[model samples]
Target: MDYIFLNHTADIYICVSGETKERLFANAVLSMYDIMVEGKRRIEDIRKLKVDCINEEDALVDMLNEFLYLFYTCGFVCVECRVKVDEKLDIEASGYYFDKDKDRLKMEIKAATYEYLRIKKDDKWRANIVFDV
Candidate 1:
């Protein structure tokens, strides 16, 4: 796993890292989904996402909230993604719709928050994200 769960009293906190920024964003998405559901998802559907943000941290949070919107409103559970980070963030995501019979709901994430959110680069890109539950 590219992400690890952290201690948070009120919401979900995670430290996600990758060799590159695109990989960092992708891992963040997967980590969010990992917190919410426990099941295997097939790549039966695809969704493209775009987010315009002032900076990388905003981009990350907005992109995550977009995925959360899709999950709550359309039942899309992204299992894999291809991300491009530039003037704008673009993502091509693939996954199946959430199936009650095949998937278990582990938790509900209302949104990704800016509080305690940070993205940094050392030997690798890393992000600390907080989800509002």
Candidate 2:
């Protein structure tokens, strides 16, 4: 797994890591979806996303919130993504709408919070994120 769940008193916390910044972002999204739903997914839709932030941390949070918006408003569940982190965060996400027959909602994530958000890079890129549930 590229991400792991962490202990949080009032929300969901996860530590996500990847070999690259792009992968880190992608893994973060996947982690969020993993927390919310279960079961198989098919690529029935594709979304192009771009987040403009001052720094990596903001980019990460904004990108996650964007996905959450899609989930709650559009019923879009992203199962996979390709990301590119440059001056702007760019992503191509593929997934399907919530299928009652095939998907199960497990958790409700209100938003990705900046409360304890931290992005770091050593041998790999790592981010600590908190989600308001």
* TM-scores of all predicted structures: 0.96, 0.95
Error of 2 at 54 (Å): 2.0
Error of 2 at 36 (Å): 0.4
Q: Residue by residue across 7-124, what tens digits does model 2's lDDT show?
A: 9888988999999888999999999999899875668999999999679898998999999999888899988899988888889999999977878999999999998889999999
TM-score of 2: 0.95
Candidate 2, which segments miss by more than 4 Å at Cα? none
Instruction: For model 2, state the Cα shift of residue 88 in Å.
Output: 1.2
Best by TM-score: 1
Query: Against the true structure, candidate 2 has what lDDT?
Result: 0.90
Error of 2 at 126 (Å): 0.3
Q: Summarize candidate 1's per-residue lDDT along 1-133 as a digit string, tens digits.
A: 7998899898888899999999999999988888899986668898998999569998998999999999998889989988999988989999989988888989999999998898999999999998989
